[model samples]
Target: MKLTLRLGKRLNRSWQVDAMLMLLLGVFGAFMAIPLIYVINNAFKPLDELFIFPPKLFVRNPTFENFGDLLQVMKGSWVPFSRYIFNTFFITAAGTAGHILLASAAAYPLAKHKFRGHKVLFTIIVLSLMFSPHVTAIPNYMIMSSIGWIDSYKALIIPAFAFPLGLYLMKQFMEQIPDALLEAAKIDGASEYRIFWQIVMPLVKPAWLTLLILMMQMLWGADGGSFIYSEQLKTMHFAMGQIIQGGIARAGAGAAVAVVVMIVPIVTFLLSQSSVIQTMASSGMKD
Candidate 1:
């Protein structure tokens, strides 16, 4: 009877813990979602509704005027609106693609190979993550200027290829691969590069998806920082800033830009979320 009571108590405590976790998660989700919901609603709100005293969380009457205004605003641009779109798309695509390939390549060797100073190198990388990118921005700018890469795409894309966090995550994921599988490939006359491309790459589909999502988030809303100079080289984010600069009369258009700026990352995350979760589950540090 005593043992039965103890078991029952244990089960009760587990249930209590589970309930607490669920409640906390629900509250947190609601808090995070409220702003996103408001943003979506605001995008459809006409200018009058936007400025209504006491504001609103939802639109009673919806209209496409904001989006239309966005196009109209862009139509008067000195530079073609399409040029800004192309620049943003190109920068994001090039930066993300380069980061993934280079980060994955660097990760493979760090995870599987034993090389001199390897541990030290990885230690430095982890340490580097503790500092903010702002700390390195000046030096990075100096290096870019020294190389005559200022006002060019290479300045933006090349430095991103060595982002420490991506390399760290990719390395951790790669470590989950069995050494035996790699050895088997080697015995079968597979070169290191061939094994990496054919055998190893396919197995980490979820990690790649996770990496792609991270890279997308970093690149999608970029404004070309101090690296880009030419008017034609400016990104959609710069155009968004110009729209927002229109002030009160263009508030709805600004909201439309916000919606567009937010949608790409949100859609990308939704598409890759399942894979990211699976990858993260398998990537937990193991003893």
Candidate 2:
């Protein structure tokens, strides 16, 4: 009877701790949401009301005039806003697809196959992730310029395809799959490509989704500001910059554009496999 009581007390304590942790996490999530709330709230307010002293959390005169103005600009641009959106979409899609395909292919060999200098190759790939893009920016730009890829989609998309982080994440996820499964496939006369596509790929779907979310976020916002600023081939962020420079009338319009721009990715992320994000978060805590 005493032992039973002790066990019950321990279980109750664990529940209490979990409840407290959840409450803390809820508070942190609200704090993180504040900035997004602020941007959205201000996006609907009139320009005159925007700079009001003490600031209004709720707009007394919410209007869609800003959105209207932005739409007009988008419709009338010599280099249409649609073009910028298209460029961003294509580059992001191509880069992400390439990353997933190449990373998965590269990781399979590194994770499952035996060959000469495989360890060296894997080590180099892992080490490459430590090297920041900023450190290589000048060299990369020079190479792009030399190859005549500046202000082109190739410059943006091709360089991004070599994603070390994606490769590393895939390798880690692939390791979690049992080797016996692959060997069994081999016994059944399955090719390596078939084994990878049919068997391994499905098991790592969570990791793939996580990488997709991450890559989409990065590529969708791929301004790099200094690199891709040419007028002929400006990205969405660069177009927003141009709108901002057009002065106060366009300020509200710019904010409205930004709000819309921000929503697309956020909604896409939330809608596409949010469960994977939760799984990844839980996994991180375990590690």
Candidate 3:
């Protein structure tokens, strides 16, 4: 009877610990959510309301005027916002697709095939990740200039395809696949290419989706504000900057643009990977 009582006490203590941890996590989550809520609320508020003393937290006259003003500015701007969107879309799509294809193909050989220098090559690739993009920016700029790719999509898209981090990630994910599966395919007269395309790609869907989400976030949030501004190309962020500098009358418009820009990537991310996020979280735990 004494031992049963002791076990019950220990179980109760464990439950109490779990409840306390959950409460702490809830509080942490609320803290992180505050900034996002503030931004969203301010986006809907008028300029005067934003600067009002004590700050308007829950009360504000929400209006679509900010959105209208932003659209008007976009229409009047010298830079073609539509064209900039197209340009960014092309660069992001080409870069992402290229990264996935090349990285996955390269990873397959490294992970599955036996070859001399494979480890050395992978080591070099991993080491390359340590090199900051800023360190090579000057050299890359010179090369791009020499190749006459300056102020062109090629300048952005081509270089992005060479992401060492993507390659390393694909390699690590592929390593989890069993070697016997490939061997069985080979015994059945399947070529290495067929095995990879038909068999391996499907199994690593979670990893691929995770990488896709990451790549999209990187490309979408790119510091193209400066590059586009300097080149006189009107990206959404550049357009927003122009609005911000216009005057207080345009503050609401700037906020509107900011809200739109922020929402697009976030919505795209959530919609595309809502299912995959759970898979990634669980898989990562196993690792």
Best by lDDT: 1
Q: Which ten residues in a row have the lowest lDDT in candidate 3?
A: 225-234
- Per-residue lDDT for 97-208 in model 1, tens only? 9998998999999999999999999999999899897899899999999999999888878887888899998888888888999999999999999999998788887888
Candidate achieving higher lDDT, 1 or 2: 1
Error of 2 at 279 (Å): 4.9
Off by over 4 Å in 2: 1-18, 224-232, 273-275, 278-287
lDDT of each: 0.89, 0.81, 0.76
In terms of TM-score, which candidate is stronger, 2 or 3? 2
lDDT (Cα, tens digit) per residue for candidate 2, span 234-281: 778777767768887787887787797787678867877765765476
TM-score of every prediction relative to native? 0.90, 0.87, 0.85
* Cand. 3 TM to true fold: 0.85
- Model 1: how far residue 36 lies from native, Å: 0.9
Sorting all predicted structures by TM-score, with the top scorer first, yields 1, 2, 3
In angstroms, the error of model 2 at 14 is 6.1
Per-residue lDDT of 38 in model 1: 91
